[model samples]
Target: MPKDKPLNAAARFQKTLDFSAADYYDQCRNRTYACCFSVENSPYIWENYANGSEKGKACIVFEFGKLRAMLNSALNPEGAILFYNGNSCRQIFEVNYGLVHYVPWGSHRTNEKHLSNPILYTYLKSDRFCEEHELRISLSAIGIGHFALKDGSLIEFPPTLQLGFDFRNAIASAAIREILLAPGADSSFLKTELSKLRIEPAPTSEKK
Candidate 1:
């Protein structure tokens, strides 16, 4: 696919879908921004090729778009927050289960919606998600306090999956929210943790 083809294809896809317009729109949103729904985690083992300085440890690479999706899903906002990288953000901590560390990865989409679709490949292959990152995107679908589904279903949040979507996003999501919003939360925690690894932008850097 080329830079100027996704919207046309997606728009065509939107018109041809069998689901409701809302579902159709969300699908388009996720597809156009795969990173918004997926993550690539790896052990911080100083694998410079993968984690240049982020080594001898463990961490989750929150896909930029995926992080947005997670937060949007949690916050239950209208559409994309339009959150771009380079814009300084505060770190939230003080929750339980440690989801507090899951912050947005600092990489922005250089091109427009028509340009090379954005992706988070470097972290995808960072050797974390493949091995231990059982990030179950399904958990993100419902039960999150921030997200009010189209069907009006607000159930209990699931336990946070160690790396991905293994247990419950509801519980994990709440914890994450607490951490980020907690009074004690600070930037040092995130900066120190983020600096531990060498994150790379998606090589393909495009969505399907």
Candidate 2:
């Protein structure tokens, strides 16, 4: 779809539904900005992606937008603080945006945390909800990958299907109050880790 077409399609979608004016507005917004929501005091849930162990109690949620903006203003940062599982075989993740971007450092999962690692990066094959979905991070060990549902519903993929990254940056793009980071992650660490990544803006040709 073209850049201008989404809004027009969204408008048409709204009119076809039997929703009232107010309800129609809400539905259109939901469709236009899928996976977006407020999380002022919303409870966060965390678990071992490889195992179902309860690790939610150890995580600390921060507004990603505020943190991102604040860190950009700083200079000579150290490294972002990230939660560690202390176990090599287990992977821990917050269930909100399906984060798979692991902080690289002295950790057991050394191979999984690198920003440029091919196993961690993924091309978005398809999405059932978000329109602005594309290349995502896939944490295969936990059965989660890119373009996965944001409603926190887990599904098993076929053994032959290789998964990609699952982190949700779009839904958390503006004033990301709902995105969850590891419990101990800090600005300095995030700066150091992010600086090492070969990230770039997606090309216009890739946007669906």
Candidate 3:
């Protein structure tokens, strides 16, 4: 008989950021929308997450149109957190209170982790801001296969935009984040002139 495939074991436990929900609640600080379980009673959630029971449950990154839906499901209006690393969410895409896909400010991640859900990040300073921004943004890009190494992963092949541009040398993913960050960014493509690169889209509309 053929050997059985290895089971996809649950993910390992991890510690959450060093801040209590009360600290954020008192001043409405560092609470972004659409990330984890709850900054409130976070210590309790942290304990559970550290025990490996919360692995597959947490959000990983954006999933197209789900961001807005999750926010509306939040139990508390102030439960929103700045960021989330899909690694930390207790439920995959467990958004609440109209907060689906809408990432809050000052949230953090040193590398790309928003592939599975998009609402994972660490709050900066645990100090939340009142006013947010116009339109949401994505920190990473959707790739052909599994995520690439942090160093120079996205590349152009015969780079060309169907919109009539070339970006043979542009860091496509990071550049998108930049364009979102700064207003009036040169929203142009085709970094390597007209005839130097190639870019193509998927031939089918099937979901992976």
Candidate 4:
């Protein structure tokens, strides 16, 4: 929504929408936060995410079911709500996880269903990235304003929001299956740090 950049370029499809649909898309973008993972152990992901740095990259493999369960239990408690903007904004905290749907970038036609359901639009991506086999976990809290105010005017909040989870405990339990180091990563350093957390680095070929 901010700019037609690589990560959010799919948002450009908003141009195809009328005012009402575009307004809904903007609302969804403001309230949703998403995290992406690959179903495969990809060298491309390692290289790009690490910004071509060789020695500091590592990936932790999670058991999908366990990870999802932990996240749902921790983040989405029953009956959570926030009162804002003269309304009771019920917390629609969803732990939705699934494979991403990729379409050709040149295909710009708007789907009727997607116009009605703007949140689903978040799962669409350019087919150029299909090789990543991406799985996304999106959390949304609708009807709440993510902003700050100073002196009776709106102030800019940080670009990213921090959502906390008990990951250390989850890792100690069954949420994490293994940790894989990149080709040139400092294995010894990582192993030592993981040791403090009682996690041992495992071979990349190891299966959950």
Candidate 5:
């Protein structure tokens, strides 16, 4: 038997960024798509995630197609597009891209069985390679894993696009929230990008 260790943020971050393309895809071979879940209340999700608690909140089941669509859409300043009940959701997060791949499903060991369901992982840190580019962009990659719940439930996510050209880095939640709360600002570029991706807020839900 193996001992389960507590989740450490620093350690988790380190493990995720140390993978090559071959290493990532080899683990993802012949895996089936599982279910997707939504964290409607992000604070709760973050709190639980921060404490290393597997299941601290309830997640509403979401659509797999919608998740794929949003993730495949053009990168936005708001970060990755998350769908809540099939509508475009801005509250979505990039989930520490590297952590997405390295997380062990049932046990702490890294293996193919544990790599079944992978999602698009976004590297949020800003990089300014050229002074000509105005905005800093994060690199997007693919990963697989899920958040294990205490009650034997798992919240799954879909794979994000790994386009080398897409530079939309994950934006901070505070900034996203501000944009949602205050509708007016200089977001012409953002609006144009969202339109290109066919992303819109769910009719029933308020912009968050």
Candidate 6:
């Protein structure tokens, strides 16, 4: 999950849109899952994400195009199928990817145009985090199984769901470029673990 500053998606729309619109946006957002990455492998990222941990910290460098292709192929092959009222329906399962746009707080104002596609708000962020240089991959399945119907009754599913992908296939596809261990990470432990999996760890680089 990606955390944002206070003035995020919902806050940006609260003042401009009506209550219903805002509520709908929140519902849609709840069904969305996002993964964030940074273009730069920086000390700031290690300080915040690694938390000075001495173990279990590593930054994976991925070939973005191959990664995207692998995700699309593994997770949403032939689109996603849904059951509504006992009838099967097909919905395109799309993964949206783009750079995060940072702007001053309160600069984003919702308008009539946004009503048709409010999920665009997810990619916006407060300028305070500009140093992150974030690239985000998000999947929004607003109608997954939330409103499944069976024999004239609503079949409820969990509000949140987990999605998985083929990790071994991703690695085999040459999606991973390198795996950089964080400063002070437990190199011996990590190397041994990776070795057991037959993975060769990249050489440790001098800390910045």
- Model 5 lDDT per residue over 50-138, tens place: 24323222222333344334444544545645443345444323322122122333454323233223333221112231112211122
Regions of candidate 5 where Cα sits further than 4 Å from its true position: 1-61, 76-108, 111-208
Candidate 4 TM-score, C-alpha based:
0.69
User: What is the C-alpha local distance difference test score of candidate 6?
Assistant: 0.65
* Candidate 3 lDDT tens digits, 79-178: 5332222222222122223222333334432233211221322222222321221133212222222222235353322222111112322323222111
Residue-level lDDT tens digits of model 1 in 77-144: 34222221333222211111111113223433223443331222212222223333333232123111
Best by lDDT: 6
Deviation from native of the Cα of residue 121 in model 2, angstroms: 10
TM-score, one value per model: 0.21, 0.18, 0.16, 0.69, 0.18, 0.70
The true-versus-predicted C-alpha distance at residue 207 of model 3, in Å, is 44
- Model 5 residue 194 CA deviation in Å: 18
Task: Provide the lDDT at 13 for model 5.
Answer: 29
Question: Model 3 TM-score?
Answer: 0.16
**Which segments of model 4 are wrong by more than 4 Å?**
1-19, 52-54, 79-92, 143-158, 195-208
The TM-score of candidate 1 is: 0.21
Estimate the lDDT of model 1. Answer: 0.31
* Per-candidate alpha-carbon RMSD to the true structure: 17.7, 21.9, 21.7, 7.2, 18.5, 7.0
Q: Which candidate is the best by TM-score?
A: 6
